[model samples]
Target: MMAGSGRDESGAGGVDDAVRELLLLMPRMVGRVKRIPVPEALQSQSLAPRHLSLLSCLLFDGPMSVNELAARLEVAPTTVSLMVADLSAKGILDRRADPADRRRRIVAIVPERHDAIAAWLAPGAAAWRRVLTPLAPAQRRLFVDTLRAYEAAVAEERREE
Candidate 1:
């Protein structure tokens, strides 16, 4: 297996190929994402890239406290708090006292805006789905499983640092 050609089969023969393909493709994908126009609704909101990152974090991880968000983003809690405050002012996010801990506030994306964000992301999702559409059912299952395992490995590498 040629290491650079991405033909290596780490486990499932095509798993390494897929992983390498994705690794190579990631930067271009990110570049495309960075170019996604800020929708009219968000344009007047004074949102920054970091704010979008925060929104993505909340969208995927569910509501979390300021400290948790800070830890996840590797920033200060005060930073997350300020960003949350700004987004809340724009009606893009909601903040409420945590049910389990009144002293803590749980921040979340407004349900109404979730679809807008999803729309912004829809093209990329569609592109991947299109790529996967022709594969056999079992292969699609393997792809998902392989993707999850790859994500875990990457996350573990980050943790070790």
Candidate 2:
């Protein structure tokens, strides 16, 4: 496949094309969204992309150990430790000794900051909603289903490796 193109041997070439287009567009789209100037209230404590990604992972997956986080992020353990410490100091993350293993530390999103993070994500969420609004309900459902299938396929491939 080309950098931004997908080849389809089957009859679902249009679906493959749409998926490929979305894959190509999403990174650029998110980069633009990330570059949107932060509001004055949030500017003083703006988050880097990595920080936001870590927070998102914690928010969605709940508490996790440094090693686990490193695996999920595909980063060095020391890198995750640094990030965890930085986020903890910033009050965006909280770290505690794991109950199951006192030797391990668990990091989780700060509950108090959930609203702030959600608010900061509102613009990007709204943009996606608006983009999907043009699609018919059935088409939207199919699109989401297709994406989920694609995600599962990718995960399966990773597991096999």
Taking the tens digit of each residue's C-alpha lDDT, what string does model 2 give over 1-161? 34444554434467666667789998997689878665444466656878766766776678999898889887799999998888788777898989988988899877877776767766776887998999999999998898778778889989999
* Predictions in order: lDDT: 0.82, 0.78
Write one digit per residue (lDDT tens) for candidate 1, span 1-161: 65554555565547666656877998897798788887766677776778876877887789898899999887899999999998898899999999998998999889888878767667766887899999999999998898778778889989999
After superposing all C-alphas onto the true structure, candidate 1 shows an RMSD in angstroms of 6.1
TM-score of each: 0.58, 0.57
Best by lDDT: 1
What's the lDDT for candidate 2? 0.78
Give the clash count for model 1.
Answer: 0
